[model samples]
Every structure is written in structure tokens, then in C-alpha cells.
Target: MKTFKLNPYRIGFRTIKTAAGMAIGVIIAKQLGVINFSSAAILVVLCVKNTKMKSMQAAWARFASCLMGLIFASLVFELLGYYPVVLGLIVLLFIPATVVIGTQEGVVTACVIILHCFNSKGVSLDFILNEILLIIIGLSIALLLNLFMPNRSRELEDYKTNIEQEFQLILSEFSEALKYVDIKLDHRMIAHVQLTIEKAKSVAFMDVENHFGRNDNSYYHYFTMRGEQALLLYRMVGLINNVSRSDQLHQQLSELIHEMSQNISGHDHTAIRLHDLYAIQLQLKDHQLPTSYEAFHSRASAFQLLHELENYLHIKSKFGSLKK
Candidate 1:
């Protein structure tokens, strides 16, 4: 028998918070003797999100939508009387109204309120007040649960470090490939880098939204720069894949790539790296052309790689300047 290792599936903090908030909302609604108390729990499940800003926005939208639904249901059902046809008309009219008012996020909750009115046989002042109470209970619980969002800066930093390490490994592999020291390269690392960059950017944006009146978006900007550089890395990898043979040009380009990998960290010396890349570009331009088509293609690829390297350095420089 062979032993198998299982991958871990971790539950996110937001999910746990939502569950706890829903439980609390149900308890509060029951204690207050609000009819249809389960509706409050449903609203809590719907409104709570990963960040406090999002939760607050969602709660506001749901509250507004519920109010509109209550008013619309009362008018339509009271004037025309409760009928299946009236319910159909309400759905048709209310959905468009919610969309027009930009409270579309609350559409489902609005429908829940409308259905409660139908089940209760008519919309009355008491029924409307009970629905409003449910909405308040749910939104209040969600808001309180999301009040103290834990700072994710440390997690963002960890993502950045992982991304940097992966980038370094990719550059080291490129250097070895150019030197004819490695024939096998894992292209999957490119996809991994892309995924990591996306995760970092998401975390950074959440961090920005967690605060108020803070204009500093250094982490967001940093991940955005890395995203641009990742595109250049993709192109570089494509060029490297085309090289079937190595020569003197390959050797020189390999040395340059090694230098680039070293300078990728502590981007303070990016100016110097850009200068070196320019010199290499000029040297490649003026050098004698190869007779063989394959060698010529290889040199051309190296030239393109140099262009990408220069762009990468410029992006690093711009990001570094933002910090100062």
C-alpha cells in the first residue's frame, strides 16, 4: 500500500467572520421578537465580505434595497390587492428600479423582503416595520463583526517575498539556459509567478481599502510594477525558448542575465543596471552579423532580451523613486 499526502484546504478568515456574524444576528433577532428572524441571518451571510469597506457598502445597499422593496410592495399590493399577477408585476418593476438606483447588490435581499410580504398575505405597517428591523439587525451585526479588520500587511509582505524568490529562481534558470548549462526548463513557473502577482495585488488593494484618508499606496504600486515586469519576463522566456544553439553571444547574454538576477533585489542600483543594458544593446548592434541563419536568429533574440531587460530596470527605478 502506498501512503498519500493530502493538500490542505484552509478556511479564510472572512468566511469564519460571516458565519459568526450570521449566528449573532439570528440570536439578536430572536431576542428582539422580530418575526421572520431567519431573514436577519440571511442578510448577514449576504453582506459580509473580505474587507470592512466592502461589508459597509454591501450593508448600505441591502438596507436601501429592502426599504425600496417594502415601499413598492405596500403600494402595489395595497392598491391592486395581493395576487399572483401582482407578484409578477412587482418582480418586473422592482428589479429595474433597483438597477436604476444602483442598489443592484441588494436585489436578492429585496426579493426576500417582497416574498415575506406575499407569504404574510398583505403588506401592513407592522409587517414593514418588522422587515426593517430584520435589515437593521443583520446589517448592524455585519458592521460590528467587520469593525476591526486585522492588518494584512504582514501577509502582503510574505507574498512579496515569495514572488521575489520565485523571480530570482526564474532569472537564475534563464541564465543557466543561455549558458547551455541546463537543457530542461519548467515553463510552469511563469504561470506560478502570474498567480502570485495577482494574489499580491489583491492583498495590497484590500490593505488600501482598510484604511481611511491614507494616500500611501506603496504596496499596491509595488505589485503593479511587478505585474508589468512579469509581462517582460514572459516575453524573455519566449525568446529564450527559441534558442537551439549557443555561441559567444549566448555567453555574454548569460553573464548579463546573471547580473540582472543579482540586481533584481535592492533595486537601488537599477540606474547602473540600465546603463549596462544600454551598453550591451549598442555592442550587439555594432557587432558583425553571423553567417548562419540560426546564429543570426539567436543574436536577434538576445537583442530583444536586452530591450526587455532595460524596460524591467526602468520599471524598478520608477517604483523605487515612488518610495522616496
Candidate 2:
């Protein structure tokens, strides 16, 4: 559910690659000359996949823009024939008209119209009509191709991987913060940690929606549990304890993670659930849990680890990739 400015450079490069490939292939296929509009339809197909909500918006825009361009081109060709004056007039109108179209939809349409008219001597109605027809054919093919294609589900696995990595990172960060107990933390570091955790939680939820979706019957309960665990970590962020107990808790947390990683396969889900006393053991190297903020942080670190485990399990369950 997050939107940000699209990376224009990346998008532009991708567009160029696609257009070049399409044009080359079309040129090679000039024998049939059937793919002109159809191959160009890729622009719309890819545009839709950019975001779920934006999927159709770009495609529709392209279609409408092309329609307008086609109409304009057709009128000019019919009335002006291929005369230089007529050609120049169409050129004069095309740029301003395209600018006003103001979307990819318009741009695609304009491109199609321009391409169709480029080899013409006069405003050729047949040329314009052919482009229009090809655009329709191309769009239909593109839409159907996209519709049948399966979207990647790697995001679900990535969600689990990211959470696992974050747990390690959070602890690494927490471990560092502890080392600097005497040194005040830079506000920037704290801000970074906070931002990471916030984004992690949001991404985890979104992962569930996109990949480990609830429509799958088994995942319903798993998603619920995962959400609950995220909440637990959010609340525990307020309850960290950094004291003599820190060292001991750290050891215990490490052991907990080791044990939890074993359960990644979920081959025996009940086996994991039945294990009791997953608490941290061992006293700190020499200290008890520290006071106040230290204690909260110590406890928070452990809680967050558990929270990540909770989310991971849900992903496994939803995806049904768990070995056991």
C-alpha cells in the first residue's frame, strides 16, 4: 500500500530496452507485418503490473491516447495528402497534441499514429486505419498474455528472509548499543533502527497480502497469529530491560533463535508448539539485568526475535513449503 516516486531512469531504460526489442522483432517479421501494433502493446501490459491499483490505469491511458492520435492522423492524411505542407502541419500539431494528452496512454497512442504516418506521402487514410487496427490487435494480445501469466510468489519467501535478516540486524544493533552503554547513542542510529522496524512490520503484513494471502484456507489462522506476534514486538519495544540480566538474556535469545530456526521446516509443527521453557538461560558474563532502559532493551530484543519467528512460521504455513 505504499507509493513513492517511480525511478525514472530505471523505467526509462526498461522502456527503451522493450521498445528496441519490439521494433527489432517486428522488423524481422515484416514478412507477415502482423505484429506492428500487437508487439507495441507490451507497453500497456507492463504498465499495468507496476502496481495493483495502477495496473489498468496506464493501459487505458495508452489506449485512449492512441485512439486520439489515430483520429488526428487520419483526418490529416485524408485532407492533406502527403504534401510537404500537410506533413509539416501534422508535425506541428502532433507535439502539442501529445503534450496535452499528458499520460503514457496518450504517448503510446501518439507513437502509434506517428509511426503509421511516417512512410506516407500524404495523410493516408489507409495507413492511419491500419495503425489503428494493429493497435487494437496488439493490445488484445498483450492483455491476454499478461492475464494468463503467473505473477511471481518469491515475495513470500523474501518476506521470511527479510524478517530473519532483520532479527539478526536488530540484535547486532542491540549488541552494539549495549557495548556503547556508556556512550550516548547518535540520534541518527536510533532513527534508523526505528525506521527499519517500522518498515519491517509493514512489509511483513504486505507480504502476507501479496504472497501468503488469506484466501488460502490454512493461512487464515497463520496470518492472525503472525499479526499478533508483530503486535507483541511493537508493545515489547516499550518493555526492554538492560541490566545484569542482559548477558544471560542474550545467550538465551541466541539459543531461542537456534531452536526456532530448526522449526523452519515445520515438519512437526506440534513438536515446536509443545516445547516449553524457551526462555533465555545463563547469567550475564558477570552482570545481572541492567537498570531501566537497559532492562527494557534486553527484554525487547528477545521479544522482537520471537516476533520474527512468529511471522516466519506464518509464511511457511501459508506457503505450505514446510517440510514436515
Candidate 3:
């Protein structure tokens, strides 16, 4: 079992936004003389999200559901005289109605409106308008705060740089392993890089969500490309591990790998590398046929390793062209 630790100093931007928005929203609502003004803070807390799209979604759902809740509460309470059982009956009907309307995310905010209606002496136009004003005030403040989303480009670039560095190191290590068959490749490094790519993908997705009008997803696609290439690397490691002996082809491939490691980056240089790789392939094909069975196995493994490396380069090539 893992123990949970709470760090007091680790505050997130979303947390700061929620706290500040709550205070500002409630103050504005109170100044506007809206009833249940403090509930404006609750709305702010509920609507604030890590991304602008999500905050907008929550605000819309809350507004739509609260409107429906007002209709339900006004009719039910006005006819039934705001009895406790009647309030219970409203909950039973309101929740399902919210789900039916696809505004279940607003259930809590809508219930707050319903409770306000129940607390009033009677359903009057003034009180209904007041609740509506509160909704507008709360959701407006949330949207306003969300308009200031922190730019994630730098953070995403960092992830990209880190992933490229990891790839460079992995390739360099693989180059060493090719030259010396006894040098065991660390599989964990590949796993860690894949995990980092996944994390970076999620951040990229959130970044896309934050930008309402922008549609470019180059960052997301970049991480996806790296993830695919990481799988190729993992497969190449397995192929390298299977080789029982090193030969001239192994040395050539190692040199190619070292060259690739030096050039590893976000930019596309796949065409040149592919050309070099194919030249090596030709050399292997025309080289003296493996004289022994063990030699044949080693040569076969090298070919398979080259094939995986080719696919890896092709992945980046396609991604680079698409980026352009």
C-alpha cells in the first residue's frame, strides 16, 4: 500500500485560480444584491478547470441545468407549497432530467438553485431573477478567469527536448552494444522514455484544449511519433540481444547508429540517414555468404535490427514532412 503525503507548498495554478475566482465572484455577486451570493463562489470552484474548454463546458452545463432546475423548482414548489417531501421529490426528478439533458455535471449547482427556491417564502419573479443573476455572475467570472490560460509552449518544448536527449542517449548506448555483444542494453531506459512520451502527449492535449481557435497539433503528433519510435527501439534492443557474435556488418551498423545518435533531434534528417542505411544493406547483401550457421544467425539478426532502424527513421520522416 502506498501512503499519501500532502505537501503544503505545492500549489497548482488551477488551485490559485479557483481560490481567487471564488473570492472575486462572491464579492461581485454580493455587490449586485443577488440572493445566495456565496453560492457564486461554489459555482466558480466547480467551473474552474485545468483547461479553457473544460471550464467553458462546465459553465454551459451549469447554466443550462440551473435554468431547467429553476423551471422545475418554480412549478413544483409553487404548486406543492415547498414541503420537505416535495423537495425530495424534486431531487428524484431533477437528477434524471439533468442526465437526460446531458448536463449531469451541473447537478450540484442546479441543486443549489433548487434549495434557494425552497428557502424563499414563495416563488416570485424577483427571487427567480436574483438566482439567474447569480448564475450569470458566477459563470461569467469563471470564464473571464479562464481567458488567461498560462502558455504551455515552453513546457511542451522542454518535454520535446528531454525526449530527444533520451533518444540520443539510447541510440548511443545501442551503438556501443552493437560493437560489444556483451554490453547489455538497459530496457528500463526505453520504458522510461515511453512513459515520458505518454505524459508529454497528455500535456500537449491539454495545451490544445486551452487554445480555442488554434487547430495545430504538431506537439501532440511529435510525441506520438516518438512513442512509435520508442517501440521500434525496444524491438531493436531485443534483436541486438539475440546476436551471438559481432562481424563487419555489426561494426558498420554501430557506426551508423553512432552517426544517428549525433544527429538525433526534432528536425528531420531521415533522407540522408536512410540513404546511408541502404548502402550498408547493399554491402551486407554482397558480402561473402555466412560460412557457418552461427555466422548466418548473426547476419540475420543484424538485418532485422537494420529493418527496425529503417522503420524508425521512416516514422520520423513522415512526421517531419507532415509538420512542414
Best by TM-score: 3
Residue-wise C-alpha lDDT for candidate 1, range 244-285, written one tens digit per residue: 555456776777778778756576678777777777767765
Cα error, candidate 3, residue 150 (Å)? 1.1
Task: For candidate 2, write residues 1-324 as lDDT tens digits.
Answer: 888876645454334444544554344335446435444545443453422323345556666777776677667767767565765677677667766766544564566455566455455456656666566554443343334323334534454455545444543543444344453323343344445445545433433343322433222333344444445444433333332233445454444444544443354662453242232222333445456775656665655644554555454445554221
What is the lDDT, from 0 to 100, of the residue 107 in candidate 1? 91
Residues forming the 10-long window of minimal summed lDDT in candidate 2:
276-285
TM-score of each candidate structure, all chains considered together: 0.87, 0.45, 0.92
lDDT of 3 by residue, 1-324 (tens): 999998778788888899999999989998887878999999999999889999999999999999999989999998888899999999999999989989999999999999999999598889889999999999999999988888888899899889999999999999898878579876899999999999999999998899889876889988998999999998888788766554668778888889889877634567788999999988875777778898888778988999999999888888773342
Rank candidates, TM-score, best first. Answer: 3, 1, 2
**Model 2, C-alpha of 235: deviation from truth (Å):** 14
Q: lDDT for every model?
A: 0.82, 0.48, 0.88
Off by over 4 Å in 2: 1-55, 77-105, 148-151, 168-324
TM-score of 3: 0.92
